[model samples]
Target: MMRPVQEICFFVSCGVFLLHGCGRHPLEVDISDIEETVHVERFDRELFEMKMDTADHAIGYFYERYGDFFDIFNTHIIHIGPGSGKRYPSFLSMFINDPANREVYEYTGRVFSDMEEINRCLTNGFRHYLYHYPDSTLPRVVGYVSRFNQGLFTVGHFIGVGLDQYLGSDCHYYDLMGIPRYLSKNKIPEKIPVDVLYAWATQIYPYNDSVDNLLTRIIHQGMLHHFVDAMFPQLEDSLKMGFTGEQLTWCRKNEAQMWTHLVEKKLLFSTDPLVIRKLLEDAPYTYYFTGESPGRAAVWLGRQIVREFVRRNPDLPLGVLMSRRDYQEILRESRYDP
Candidate 1:
């Protein structure tokens, strides 16, 4: 979940918590305590409706309801125009008038109008976070339509989700926008909590150093995946890995060959950012080894290494595992020759 820029990140995990509630009316004995469920606060819906309706207090409403977040959107999401050397009206003006963006905003609302499922997933994942790190402060979750500019981002105590980005993969607009189908397919409501929670995880368990090599970069993702697993224990691995069923099966079948290729090519320890990007960054395809190979093969390897590390150190708690920053030591200890 670590942002590629400046932001605090953290993880969701399960450990070290207990709750009990009971009552008896004999001589009087009772105890009460309730764990709160985590959920997203829907400022996006209110903001979109206000813009659409041209409400009297639209500007004031945004300023008052979202406070500094308004400034953030202006700076990051909306101030710039679609092309270089061009300009657009302020975010508010643009949102109020753009026809296509308006449709996207409405579609986003229709798709996510009922966020009970999202709330439940986040609540459960957050409980796991609370279970492991009892003292951690939960971020204030909010929803917003970002015109597909930013999917999810966090700053200070706020975690903002760009609802438009997750419209079902089959939505025709994606094709119009030239988004390849493979990448678009994962843009579903089901993946929202994982993205948000994993982003939070990066805030907590940040990669302090720059990733200069394939091993570090992929291991960074692996750690995030591992943390998400602890947080959303019931979620499928494919969802966590952002892999299709066939992609996962391919990775599994070729795990050894993949590792062998990395070693044979001397890629693991090399500090080449370009090499790292080809293996770890999202793309239509990596196109390095085989055309059929999935992109981010390094991620699969990193997950395999972390799994091996955990297997070797079975007693290490999730908290401890994340706190350790020595990737080289983790790799060495993992004995991950594969």
Candidate 2:
């Protein structure tokens, strides 16, 4: 009887041990197993490389003449220095090296399908600048390749840094389109693939940190957009061309609503240098639709200033108009008053 009782106790203990596990803690399960994959396309590396090279050459030429401005820019605009060890490769190299980043580039290309046209406009504008403003300090050959390296690192960083995870898995197709009307019309999946490739294009490099900082600073300066716009009128046509007929129609139809949104969001002057720099630092998503911080700011600010100026001076010609030296001198004299 005693033996039987002892045997029963032993079996009970064995059963409990088997059910609970043999001195093992409960295993933790990862949530990733339940996560879904985001689907998106990649960018074309060769095309991107070509574009970057063009921009780089353009910027290099500018720097050679305006090295002083660059130095001042580094001091006043950019907070960081070359010693910070930031390393930015060419946009193409970054994209090819990181397979994960391709999606964003494809999305960017789709949204801005007329990028080549826009670039052409820039090239033409630069050439015009050289021809008309022969005495100006601006570069004569503002090639795409030259401009590519000027602030490429900073521009890339503003777009790419801290954005991989946000874009890689959370990006939606409609989000890629910069049009608010389109985004409102199409509802995308909650968790879409992030476009990392675009980030590669916008990646910030160590050597260009000063350039990035200075550009951001200059963008913040009041009236700078107006200066750029007065200098480059072809940009307006280029931007308009980026929109399709349907898109333009949609924009017109929703003009009131769009303006309302812009006013409410303080985006009407979103191109203001200060406003743009803030947006770049604070709202990366907004920057994407707007273009990189200073670039988008330049466009938006140019439009705003021209609209106001044209409204006041309706007699002004639609063609490229130059501000008289006296007017610039007066503005400079009164700069502190505003």
Candidate 3:
């Protein structure tokens, strides 16, 4: 947390503006050296399939390879089943050794056989992070097939990637698994870098304040999204916002209307948790708005407020903004009208 605030502020002021190259900040860290420093472990291919012919040998290999994480691995992957603990041995055994699951493994194999491009994206993303925060802690990236349990998560210093979650949107496995179409749409390779970076960002700068109001929750998520956006400048706003291109367009077109609706309803400063969830949480769509309205409208609005706040204070560094605890102060300073 300290590193994110200190180093990011330092980097912002030093004049290194990537993309447009307009900032006065100079990059302090060498991008080339980051590859050697941060490592991404391919546990999916290397461990899961390494000795699949024999579970005993596979178990032994895992125990030796990840002695430090054997307990967590056992709890999350082996002992507990996807999304929960295994209740039936037959079900668990099928998930591990069934011919169909093996087919699923082979399916993932084709998609992830060449992780060169993904590795490069992840490396670049981490490099950008290190560039801003030189002393930032690095996580040991572990790629595993979670049977579509969790998408990606960080356990201690290890970032666990569930490879099965990215088997393309149209992959038949998703249909067989009964995953909703909307949920599987983002399971493409390009989204992996964002997922990894966002997961790491949340670990480094988690929301510490209470979420008693709609505005508070939005600003909190807005801060995280802003950090990720700065790190991945090339990613589209829609992708970072977790919206479709059309949905983003709808938001922009109706930005004024959405703001006006919030104001007319006096919902921005309201401390109603239900109201907060309606606007901020993920749903099929925001029910208050038209069906065409994108889900998570509050997050989008919060992002706008944050953008305006930064725009109004060009001299302010991102780290300083993140470090500030006064959400109300930020909103007031932003003078966010729309």
Best by TM-score: 1
Residue 102, candidate 3: alpha-carbon lDDT? 60
Q: Positional deviation of 288 in candidate 3, in angstroms? A: 2.1
Query: Which 10 residues in a row give candidate 2 its minimum summed lDDT?
Result: 1-10
Per-residue lDDT tens digits of candidate 1, residues 1-338?
21122121112222112112354211111111327687888877676666434544565666576666666765687654322122433446567567766777777766776787678778878777777677778787888887788888777777888877877777666777899877898887677888988998887777765555777767877888888877766566677778887888888888888888888889888887788788887776664657777788678889889988987987777789888777878898999866
RMSD in Å for candidate 2, one decimal? 24.5
lDDT of 2: 0.30
In candidate 3, position 331 carries an lDDT of 87
TM-score, each model? Answer: 0.82, 0.28, 0.79
As for candidate 3, its clashing pairs are 14-24, 14-25, 14-26, 15-24, 15-25, 16-25
- Between prediction 2 and prediction 3, which has the larger lDDT? 3
Candidate 2 per-residue C-alpha lDDT over 156-223 given as tens digits, one digit per residue, 9 for 90 to 100: 11211111221212234324434343222322211111112112212211112232332223222223
For model 3, the superposed segments whose C-alpha errors exceed 4 Å read 1-39, 50-70, 77-95
- The models' CA-based lDDT, in order, is 0.72, 0.30, 0.68
